[model samples]
Target: MDEETRAEILEATNRALCEHGYAGLTVQRIADESSMTSAAIHYHFDTKEELLNAFLDDLIERFESKLPCGAADPRTRLDGVLDAVFSPKDPDSDGFPVAIMELKAQAPYHELFRERFLDFDGVMRGVVADIVRDGVAAGHFDEADPEEIARLITTMSNGAHARAVALDEHPAETRRVVEDALELHLGWTPGEEVDG
Candidate 1:
C-alpha cells in the first residue's frame, strides 16, 4: 500500500526471483523472502501474475531512471547510456538481470509478458536512438540512421545479457565487447575524455 511496504514487497520478490527464478517462484516463496505472510501478499496482489507484472513494471522503471538525460554533450550521454545497458556483472549474484532473462524466455508463451517485452524493447531502443541522433548532430559520429543503430545496440545488449546469463561470463567481457562495437559504430570510445 505505502511506498515502503511496496518497496519491501518488490525487494522480496527480487530475492525470490534470484533464488528460485520465475519458473520456481510462488506466492509463498515471495512471502517467505519478504518475511510477510502469504495473506499479506495476497492483500496487496490478488494473484502471482499480478505480482510479477508489478515486478516487471518496477524493474523497467528502475532501469529507465538510470538513463542519463538533459546533457548537452552526446559522447557523455552515450557513454552513460551504454554503461547502464551493458553493465557486465554476474546475474547469478544480482538476480535482477537473470530474472529479466527468465521473463524474456517466457514472453512467447505468455501474451502479457510478450507485450511488456515489446514495450521494454521499444523504450530501450528509443533511449539509444536519442543518443545516436545527438551524437550525429554534434558531429561526433558519422551520419547514419539512428533507429538502425539503436536496434543494433539493443541486439548487442540482448546478446550480452544472454552470454552473461548462460555462460556465467564476467560483466567486463560484455562491457569490452559493447565498448568496442561503439567505437566502430559511433566513434565513441569508452573512458575517453570528451569536451562538452
Candidate 2:
C-alpha cells in the first residue's frame, strides 16, 4: 500500500469511528469520510475488523511517540504524561475519546482489541513505573513501591478517560484526586520543590 493511502485510510477510519462508533462503523462510512471508494478500502483492508485493528495501532503509536521520553527529570516526565492525558477539553470538541471507549467496551469479544489495549496499558504502566523509580532514587518520592504507584496512577487515569467520555465529566477532577493521592503517599506534589 502507498504510505499516503494508508495514512488516508487510517485518518478516515478515525473520523468514521468518531462519527458512527464501533457498532455502526462500515467501510462505506469510512469511504464517505475519505476520497476513496468502498471498493478501494476493501482492496486494502478485507474487513472492517482489520481496518479497526490498523487504526488502533496507528492511534497508540501516535500517542506513544508524544510521550516525554527525553525529559530532563522524572518529575517533569511524570507531569508531562499526566498533563497530556488529563488535559481539559470540551467533551463535545473531540469524539475520538468516545470512539475509543466504544471500542474498549468490546474488548472482551474482540481479541485483537483486547491485545492492543493491553499492550497500550502495559507500556503506559511501565513508563510510569520507570519515572517513579527514578523519583525514588533521587529522593523526590518516598520509598514506596514504584510498580504499585504506577498501577494506582494509571488505573485512575483510565477511569478518568472513561468518565470524561461517558459522563461528560471533566478529566481535571480526577487529575486533582490523583495528584492528592500522590502527594499523600509519595510526598511528591506537582510543581513543588522537593529534595532531590
Candidate 3:
C-alpha cells in the first residue's frame, strides 16, 4: 500500500481502539472506518499483533507531537510533561489516557502488550529524568537522584491516568490530582495548578 493508505489504516486503527477498546479492536472495523477493505490492512500487516504495533507506533508519534518534551528549565519541563501525560484534551481524538489505562491492565498477560507499554514508558521516564536533572543542575529543584525522580514521576503520572479513568473525571481534574501529588512529593509550593 502507499504511504497515504498506510497512514489512513493507522488512523482508522486508532479510532477503533478508542471506540472499541483493545478487546474489541479488529482490522475489519479499522478498514470500515477508513473506507478500505480488511484485505488491504492484511496486505500491510499480516497479523493483528502487527496492526496493534502499528497502532502503538502511531500513538507514540501522537504523544510526542502533542506533548513536546522541550523547555529551557527542568521544572518547567517537568510541568509540561505532567500536563502531556495527564491532561485530557485528546488533540488527536485517540482517547489516549483511557487507552493507556486499558493497556496497563492488559500488559501482565500479553508479552507484546507489555513490550509496547515498556517502550513508551521508557521514553516518558527518560524525558522525566532529564527534566529532573536539569532542574537540579539549575538550582530550580532540590538536589535529588534524577533516575529515582524520573521513575517516581512516571509512576505517578500513570497512576493519575488510571485514577482518572477509574473515577471518570475529566483531564483537567486528573491533571490537578497529579499536580498536587507532584508538589507534595517534590516539595513544590502548594500553589495553584500550573497552566499548560
Candidate 4:
C-alpha cells in the first residue's frame, strides 16, 4: 500500500522472474520473497498479468529515464542510446531480453501476456525510430530510412542481449558486435579503437 512496500513487491517480482520463469511466478511466492503478504500484492495488482505489466513498465520507464544527454549530432545520440540501454547497472538488465524472449515464446497461449509484451516492443521501436530520425537530421548519421534503421537497431539489440544471456559472451564482445552493426549498417563509426 505504501511506496516502500510497492517497491519491495516489484523487486520481489523481478527476483521471481529471474529465479522462476513466468510459469512459476505467483503472488504467494513474490510475497514470501518480499516479506509481505499476498493480500498486499493483490492490493497493488489484482492479477498476475497486471503485476508482470507493471514490472515491465517500470523497467521501460527506468530505461527511458537513464538515456544520456542528447547531442546535436545523431551519431553521438545513437552512441548515447546504446550506452544507456546496455549499461550493466540493473541486475536483471542484461538477462531481461532473454527472459522476455522466453515469455514471448509462450505468449500465444496467453493473450494478455502476448499483447503486453508486444506493446513494450512497439514502444522500443518508436523510441529507436525517433533517435534515428534525429541523428539523420543532424548530419552525423546518414539520412537513411529511420523506421528501418530503428527496426534494425532493435533487432540487433535483442540479438545482442540474447547472445549475452545465452552464450555468456562477455559484455565487451556484445558491445563490439553492436558497434560493428551500427557502423556497417548505419554508417556510424565506433568511438573506440579495436586492438584486434
Candidate 5:
C-alpha cells in the first residue's frame, strides 16, 4: 500500500470515528469521510477492526513524538503534559474524547482494542514516570516513588476525560485538581525553588 493512501485512510477513519462513535463506525462511513471507496480502504486494511487498530497505533506514535520537546524543568514538563492532555480535541470536534470513550467502553469485548488501550495507557504512564524520575533525581521533586505518582496522574487524566465527556464536568476543574495532587506528591511549586 502506498504511504499516502494509508495516511488518507487513517485520517478518514479518525474523522469518521469522531463523527460516529465506535459502535456506529463502518468502512463505508470512513470511505465517505475520505476520497476513497470501501473497496480501496479494504484493499489496504482487511477490516474495520484492523483499520481502527492502525489508527490507535498512529495516535500513540504521534503522542509519543510530541511529548519530548517540552521544557527540561520537571515542573514545566509536567505542566506541558497536563495542558496537552486536557486541551480540547480541536476547534470543531468537541466529540473526540467521547469517541475515545466509546471505544474504551468496548475494550472488554474486543481483545485487540483492549490491547491497544493498554498500549496507549502504557505510553502515557511511561512518559509521566520518566518525568517524575528525572524530577526526583534532580532534587526538584520529593523522594516519593515515580511510578506511583505516574499512576496517580495517568488514572486522574483518564477520569478527567470521562467526567468532562460523560458527566458534563469542566475539564479545567479536573486539571486543576490533578495539578494540586502533583504539587502534594512532588513538594515543589513554580518560582519557589531558587536557581542554584
Candidate 6:
C-alpha cells in the first residue's frame, strides 16, 4: 500500500496491458510481471478494474505534470504539449498509447472506463484550449474558438496515435501531420520564427 509498492504495481500493469492488451490482461500476468504475488496484488487492488482505474489516474497525473505552468510563453507551452502528444520520447515505444487505446476500446462496455477516459480527454482538451486562448490573446494566433481548436487538435492527435500504433509508422510522420493540422486550423506553428 506504500507509494513505492503502488508504483511498482502500476508499472507492472502498464507492461502487462501493453504486452497483452486489455482483452488479454490477467491478474496472474500482472503479478508475474511485477514479481509480486497475486495475493499482494489483490491486497492492494480488489479487482482488475480497480487496478486499471489506478493506472489511468497515474497516467493522467503524469500528463498534467508535463503541461506548462506559471508565466511560460503561450508558444512555448503549446509547443511543449504538442511535442509530448505527437513526438513523445522514444517514438518507437508505443506501450503507453497502445495501453490507452486498449482501455478506450473498453469504454463502450464499461462505465468506469468510460468515465475515466472522459475525464482524461477533458483535461487534455482543456490544456490545449488554454494554450490556444493565450496565443490568441497574445496575437500570436488567429482569433478562433479555443474549444473548437482544442477539439480538432485532440481528434487529430488521437488519429495519429492510432495510426502510429496500428501501422508502426514513425512518430515524426505523425508529428508532421499534427503540425500541419495545427497550422491550418489555428494559424500557429510551434517554434516558428515570427516577425515582431
TM-score of 5: 0.91
**Best model per lDDT:** 2
Off by over 4 Å in 3: 69-71, 91-96, 171-174, 184-196
Clashing pairs in model 3? Answer: none
Ranking by TM-score: 2, 5, 1, 6, 3, 4
Note the Cα lDDT for every prediction shown: 0.82, 0.86, 0.72, 0.72, 0.82, 0.83
How well is each residue in 1-196 modelled by candidate 5, as lDDT tens digits? 8889889998888889988888889999999999998988899888888888898888888777767464577767776677667765567766777888888988898788899999999989888888889888888898888889889988888998899888978777877777777778898753344463
Error of 1 at 88 (Å): 3.3
Residue 164 in model 1: shift from native, Å? 0.8
Better of 2 and 6 by TM-score: 2
Candidate 3 lDDT tens digits, 1-196: 7879878888787788788888888888888789889987898899887787767766777677766456645666676676677666556764656766776777787787778888888888888777777766777667777788778767776667666677766656656665676666566642334545
Candidates in order, TM-scores: namely 0.90, 0.92, 0.82, 0.81, 0.91, 0.89
RMSD of candidates 1 onward, in order: 2.0, 2.1, 3.3, 4.0, 2.2, 2.3
Candidate 1: give the clashing pairs.
88-171
Clashes of 5: 0
Please, what are the lDDT tens digits per residue for candidate 2 over residues 48-149?
888888988887787788688755588888888787778886455478888988889888998998998998888888888988889889887888888898
Taking the tens digit of each residue's C-alpha lDDT, what string does model 6 give over 109-130?
8888888888888998999899
Error of 6 at 187 (Å): 3.3
Model 1, 44-90: lDDT tens digits are 99987788888888868977888877475777777777778776553
Q: How does model 3 fare in lDDT?
A: 0.72
Can you give the lDDT of residue 145 in candidate 3?
77
